[model samples]
Target: MKNILVLCTGNSCRSQMAHGFLNQQLGDQAAIYSAGIETHGLNPGAVATMQRAGLDITSHTSNHVDEYAGIDWDFIITVCDHAYENCPFIPAPNAQRLHHNFYDPSKFEGSEKDTRAAFDKARDEIKAYVTDFASTHF
Candidate 1:
């Protein structure tokens, strides 16, 4: 199976969502993993948002990029500008690096409804992105 890694500033939101979507889209075609430059733990907003979409990410954990140093990744995807710009050099020389700046719903400050909307929007965008990525590359 191909090894795919989704990255973000914190493994809490965008990357987590993408990880869920990738797992669903690629199924047995690839091994999907998500990590961050720094671990912020799993975001509850992300978990709830994904749960609404019928993807349970509650079991996922926030991980530092260094954790997977030994594995050869087939693809490395950054879901936030911060992670993409500040990401350290990964040794997976042959890995295809892809990037998308997804909004951080965890950073949105608003009423509960608006915050939920933000999470939903990010989740949908991530779902669409991973769907396309999986179809094109897997």
Candidate 2:
């Protein structure tokens, strides 16, 4: 199985969700993992969004990028633009890196409904990207 890594500023939100979705959708074809440039606890909104999509990430933990050093990856996808630009070396020499930026739902500030909607939108965008990527490249 190919190993894929997803990264973001915080392992809390976007990266976590992407990990959950890819693992679910790709099944045995890929082993997906996620980490952050810096550690932050998993965001509750992120957890909620994944649960709504029928993917459970409640057991997922926010992890630092250092945890992945020395591990070989087939692919390393950055789920946020900033993280993409700042990513460090991956052990896999032939690993294909992709920048697939997604809006950070945690940045949304508004009423509860609006916050939920923002999370949903971000979640859907990531899902769409995953679907397209899987169809074309996985």
Candidate 3:
């Protein structure tokens, strides 16, 4: 199976959402993994946002990019600017690198409803991107 990695500043929101959508879209066509330059644990907002769309991401974990080590990656997607700028060399010699600066709902300070709105927006954008990614790549 093709190996794909989705990365973000923290393995909490954007990358996690992307991971779930991609997994659903690609199914057995690829192996999807997500990690952060620095692990921030899974975001509850992200999980709840996705659950609303029928994808459960609660079982996903926050992981440092270093955990992937030397696996040959087919695609390396950075979902935030921080990760794109700070992540070190990925050992996949021919991996396709992609970047998308998705909004960080975790960085927002707001009431519960407002926070959920932010997460929902990010999740929608990520879903669109992943749907497109699956059609174009797979």
TM-scores of the candidates in the order shown: 0.98, 0.96, 0.97
Residue 79 lDDT in candidate 3:
93
Scored by lDDT, model 1 comes in at 0.93
lDDT of 1 at 4: 94
Which candidate has the top score in TM-score? Answer: 1
Model 3: weakest 10-residue lDDT segment is 85-94
In terms of lDDT, model 2 sits at: 0.90
Each model's lDDT:
0.93, 0.90, 0.93
In candidate 3, how many Å is residue 86 off?
0.3
Ordered by TM-score, highest first, the candidates read 1, 3, 2
Stretches of candidate 3 off by over 4 Å are: none
Model 2 spans with C-alpha error above 4 angstroms: none
**RMSD for each of the candidates:** 0.7, 1.0, 0.8
For each predicted model, how many residue pairs clash, with residues at least 3 apart or on different chains? Answer: 0, 0, 0
- Across residues 37-64, which tens digit of lDDT does each residue of candidate 3 receive? 9998988889899999999999999999
